[model samples]
Target chain A: MYENKRLGLLYCLPFVIGVALFKLFPFAMSFALSFTQFDLIEPPKYIGLENYREMMTTDKLFPKSLGVTLMFVALTVPLRLAAALMVAQVLNFKLKGINFFRSAFYLPSILGGSIAVSILWRFVFAKNGLVNQAMTALGAEPIMWLGDENYSMWTIVTLNVWQFGSSMVIFLAALQNVPTSLYEAAAMDGAGKTTVFFRITVPLITPVIFFNLIMQTVHAFQEFNGPYMVTEGGPLHSTYLLSLYIYDQSFKLFNLGYGTALSWVLFALVATLSAVAFYSSKYWVYYAGEKERS
Target chain B: MMSSLIRSMVAMGVIALALGSTVVSGQELRFSWWGGGERHEAFLKAIKLFEAKNPGVKIKAEYTGFQGYQERLTTQIAGKSEPDIMQVNWAWVSAFSKSGDGFYDLRKSASVMKLNEFTDNDLALGTINGKLNAVPVGFAARMFFWNKGALDKAGVAIPKTWDEMFAAGKALRAKAGTKAYLIDGEGYDMILMSHAYVYQKYGTPYVDPKTGKIAMSAAALKEWASIYKRFQDEHVATPLPLRASLGGVEKPTEQQPDWVAGNWTGNYTWDSVIRLRGSTLPGKGSELDVGDFLTLPGAKNSGVFGRPVHMYAVSKRSKHPEIGAKFIDFMMTDPEAIRVLDLSRGIPSTAIAFKQLLKEDRLRPLEVKAYARIATLNRNNAITPPAAQFEHPRMQKFMREVFEQVGYGKINADEAAKMLNEQGSTILQRL
Candidate 1:
């Protein structure tokens, strides 16, 4: 028993060491860096609370970026969940050549945030790009999709929503697991297909829907690559998400301390949001094995 | 287990042998730069020549486009993993060399690198606090480059001055509708053009370097903003919305499809970028021509923007600083090297090198013509703009923001000026 335990510990060693060195160490360093004034070129000087104060009170971009990030999350999360659920419903049917459609839909999620996709997206949304060309051909005025501040954020949201394959797969799995007997029973009870779906299918998949909701919400809140690559947090900083702001501050501007401070604020935000999500999930999330509470 | 262990041991031995051979064979240096197709091609040729002469001393060239080069270099420097030889920006001198010791002191290798090849004035630009950290490759200036065919096709003559440019804008818009603007009035372009306007009126640096304060008082800034506001209002340049629809202003005009298509007819850019701009036009059938930088009708001073060309500096962390210095010497002075480099960077920094390029016909006809104009401006009595220290991202962004606010009518000229003084003070104070 002791030898078996030792083997198990040995097997886990690499993962523990990897997390300690790459993840946890950097996490702690960034936290410590939040209090300092560092330009990365010069040695970091401790200037307690100055970076935080500057960001909150003086920097206008901070609040603007935060608002932009929250909007992206609110829009993309619900839309992505809806898209994934609708597609997964159809995908769950035992239809012919279904695997090809599944792979085709999954391609974007697998290749999402890559440079190739981002470049392709720019061409699609550019003023003289294919979409605008088609619009002009149809005798309609061409819209500046990525150029206008009003519509630029939607481009990134559309890009994010299109890559809903992971959530769809999870929904598909949960749909398959729902016993056919329950649907038949509801059908025999003089219920129509829509009635059976509402009474039988949905409640049965509440656990999976709740899971996807939380996952997509977190993912949408931290969305960076889609906006960074597509819109460049630009056209008057319209698409400037919080993650992009942090990256620009830390990497582009070399204000690592301020970047760290911004990241910590983001961490608190995401943590609070996730906590709220979990608390709310308890009311709606049904479990397979747990007894129902009166 | 024995077979696998033996295989692992052999692998380790092979790794060690490979590492040992690299160290024993010769010095390996990494040289990094950012440029367009022309520069990358020329630099690759220069590297090939350098490698052939240096024998076992290998130099690896790391190249990228100009975007994010500074940011990447900053991170690499912070990590102490920068290239040995760097194509350093002039503004980076003030940024990285606080004590004048951020880069390797090239003075130590003067004999090998041939420091006497450069004129004193050229040498002075790279010298900081008595430390020769970098050497200027050439001197460059910002000017107006017009596509002659585009304007001629529209029956618009080449604009020789601000009045002509304004008239051209009116005529072109009447004739071509929204087909073209006199130039791209991106935020930075507007700021530079505003400097020329303001400097001609007030013979002083935009910002007082000594006090680290803006030279233009709130009243002066207000006047400047009003003039700038007038320029944009008259539609002499592409407005923000149109420029945005076109593409990023930071990208070379050549890279923009609008520019290639002759929808944007002129550019306000540096001399170094003119060829790249020209190269992008011929394929699209537009004839690139050097036009006169627009001046006020009776302008007091040219207010010509001039600066040292991009320089080569060695990282203090480089294990092979000597080899890096030798490479710089070859790149800057060698006859064969100059033939390969041509005039991709700019006119050569040294007189001898220029004569060589001219004699060998290495400098293209257009380059020679461009150089004559630049030489005339260089010799003119003009107000030197603020030092590169003022080229900080914070200051540049602040300048652009103030101009943008005024241009967009988000705020009035007086408000923009007052806000600039207040916020500019804060920005300077932090630095």
Candidate 2:
């Protein structure tokens, strides 16, 4: 037993080394950098709490960017997870070309971080673009989807939610694992489709939903490319997210110290939010073959 | 398994050593610049010519699109892995040349090349704190490019002053009936032109020399912002949404000489854009006429509307500072380099190269005209340096936002002015 445990650890050595080097080392370094004023050229100067203090008090754009990012996260996460669940439920139906539909829906998730999709997004939402042209064809006024501050955030949110395939696939797998006997017994009791879905299907998939919600929430908060490429945090800084702001400061303005500080703040916020989500999941999440120990 | 791993590691070490030796063996220089495909091709051709002349030096050309070049360059600099020869913008001079010894002092290197060959202003732009840090390749000034055919069709005369320009725009709009406007409502360039006009009228640049800060004169800000607001209100400029759809007048053909091809009027841009337009949109039935850089009426000196656009700076930590300085000198003075580069990097700054190109008839007509115009303007006026804080990306973002706000009519002139004062200072301080 001891030999087996040693072998297991030996086999996991590569992963352990990778985690230490790539993740832990960088995390610690970034934390250290947060305390210093480094421009990446001259030696880093230790200026304790200056970056954080400035960000908290003096940085006019920080609060605005933080608010915008939070607003985006708030709008996107629940909507995206719910949409994914709905689609997964539908895909779970014993329909023709199920494999094809699944693949087609899953394609966007695969292409989510790709440059091609972002370019396509730009074209789709650009003024006189596909969306506006469609609106015109429908005898409605063409909205300035990207150009107007009012509608630009929605454009980004829609882009985020549109790639719901990853969560959908997970939900689909979870639905397949859901016991067929429960649904059968419910049907025999003259339970309607809606009743079965709400009572049986939903409870069984709650764990997966919870998993997806946390992941998507974290992802939504770190949303950078959509806003960076499409609106460029513009139309009066409406789409400026914290990540984009950090990037601008570090790379564009060469303020590595302040950028690091902003990054740490973002990390803390995500960590706290994730903790809260995990804590809340205990109440709603349900796993198969588990008693109500709580 | 351990033996196999050892074998693989040995092989990897051998490969790494081989690659390192190969890189060290060659007189390799990594040259970086940001431009489009044509510019890349031209640069490659120039590199090939240089390599053929000096067989030992092998030039490795690196290029990127202009959008995020500065950011990428900064990262490379911070990482202590900057390219040997970099095409740096002039705005970066003050920031990059932080200390006197940060970049290669060109004056102390390369006896073959002489600095006296280039224009005084061009040479001066490269000099940070009396040390020649970089070499200027070209000069470009923001000016108006009018479509003669469109103006003729509209039967409107070119305006001499701001008020006249407004009246002409209104007349053109009235005549064309929503199909045309005098200029694109994209941000800042025209406003800068307007600022220059006011500066010429007042004989004070945007920055006050005495205070060593931005001369945000309330009157000047109000006048400039009000004029911009008025331009929007009069429909002389395209609405924000329309302008946004056009993608800043440079991207869409319908907005360019095509707008002229379709019978609209003039646009404002640096002169090189005219050459680009002429070549790209050949035989578009539109002729580009270089208009005078507008001066405010009754001005003491019509201040020259030019900035030191771009300079070639050696990295402070360059492994081969002498080699970098030599390359810059070659770029500035070499006849072969001059022929290969042509006016692609705007008009040549060197008087010898300028004369050589002029005699050879290699200089573009547009470039010649631009140089002449700049020279004429320079006789009476001095070049104004951009505000140091304004060089920051935050300031650019702030300006872009305020411009959008003003363009979209979200806030009036008063609100924009206030935001500019507050946000502009904040960005500066943050930097």
Best by lDDT: 1
**What DockQ does each listed candidate score?**
0.46, 0.42
Off by over 4 Å in 2: A1-18, B1-15, B209-211, B239-241, B245-264, B278-286, B301-304, B359-364, B418-431
Runs of candidate 1 with Cα error greater than 4 angstroms are: A1-11, B1-25, B185-187, B209-211, B282-286, B381-385
True contacts kept of each: 0.31, 0.42
Per model, how many backbone clashes are there? 0, 0
Residues B55-122 of candidate 2 have per-residue lDDT tens digits of: 78877888998888998888787777888889988767667666656677777774745777876777
lDDT of 1 by residue, A1-294 (tens): 876677677668879999999999999999999999898889999999998898889899898999998989989999998898889889988899999988888788988768678767877888878888999999999888876878888888988999999998998899999999997887788899888777788888999988888788778878888887777776677888999888878876668999999999999898998899789877877888979878
Scoring the B chain of model 2 against the true B chain gives a TM-score of 0.91
Q: For residues B118-225, what per-residue lDDT tens digits would candidate 1 score against the true structure?
A: 877667777878888899888877788788888888899998777788898888888777666767645586677777777666655567756667777666677788
Can you list the residue pairs that collide in candidate 1? none
Task: State, as a TM-score between 0 and 1, how close model 1 is to the true structure.
Answer: 0.93
The CAPRI category of model 2 is acceptable
